[model samples]
Target: MPVAVGPYGQAQPSCFDRVKMGFMMGFAVGMAAGAMFGTFSCLRIGMRGRELMGGVGKTMMQSGGTFGTFMAIGMGIRC
Candidate 1:
């Protein structure tokens, strides 16, 4: 186990542990939330019978790209 000592046993995680944990947690949470919202938004768009690309698709694509870019930037900042 990669443990660090402090007031809290988990106060500091090793560099490798931080990277691994960050990736795992971020991926898991992101996927779950993204999937749920994506599904909900798709269904909502369908119900409206709007041109998806003109209406919701563009927003969705932009949001996805932004999310990815921000995550990449955040990881870089962490190091």
Candidate 2:
């Protein structure tokens, strides 16, 4: 997204754009958090090998989706 000169050079982004940006940012953060939490939880539960990978992956996806949805809604509000 490029900014323009003064006086309405660049128009406001659409709702979809805002939501997309928010979702992406949230997903990045969520995945990091999920990875840490999932890794620890699985290890604490004595999970290993494929089971640990699956658990971490599942947790990451769920957290990413949850965060993305909330961030999208929050950004889309635009007020």
Candidate 3:
């Protein structure tokens, strides 16, 4: 009688797999950083609940402005 082997295989990742992995890693890192900074800023400002939410909103608005400027610059460069 022949012994059966456990299922095991290795394969190289394709470009699509690489892109998927990269996106997942980036999303996880961004979430972690956002949580840390949001909490820290709120604590530093002595905010709670609604106040913390407001602080987050303000930060998001500021981030939007910065992101917009950078995106515009990148677009200009590409054009």
Candidate 4:
């Protein structure tokens, strides 16, 4: 007979871990949205590759930071 082991040797994640994961997911989504918006705005203003890439990167970081902060606050309030 062989013993069975759970995947990754873990059954479930802790509450804090789950909350962190959720915050990261939210940040990722926000970053994507920011990038899309930045790209479109830059294109509308006739920006080329380098400028467009720079705008997208800046927007993504800003949005991700905002999202993560709000997520942490909301989680704190809930807990």
Report the number of the highest-TM-score candidate: 2
lDDT for each of the candidates? 0.58, 0.87, 0.59, 0.77
The clash number for model 4 is 0
Q: Candidate 4 — which pairs collide?
A: none
lDDT of 3 by residue, 1-79 (tens): 4433445644545545555555455545545555567778898979998989877766655554554445445444543
TM-score of each: 0.43, 0.83, 0.48, 0.70
- Tens-digit lDDT string for candidate 1 (1-79): 6455888554675565555555555555555566567657866857455554344455445555556555655665686
The stretch of ten residues in a row with the least summed lDDT in candidate 4 is 1-10
Please give the RMSD of candidate 1 to the true structure: 6.6
Model 2, which residues run further than 4 Å from truth? 1-8
Q: Give the higher-TM-score candidate: 3 or 4.
A: 4
Better of 2 and 4 by lDDT: 2
In the predicted model 3, the residue pairs found to clash are none
Write down the RMSD of all candidates, one decimal each.
6.6, 3.9, 11.3, 6.5
Per-residue lDDT of 20 in model 3: 52
Off by over 4 Å in 1: 1-13, 47-79
- Candidate 4 residue-wise lDDT, 34-56, digit = tens: 88887888889998988889988
Evaluate residue 78 in candidate 3 and report its C-alpha lDDT on the 0 to 100 scale: 45
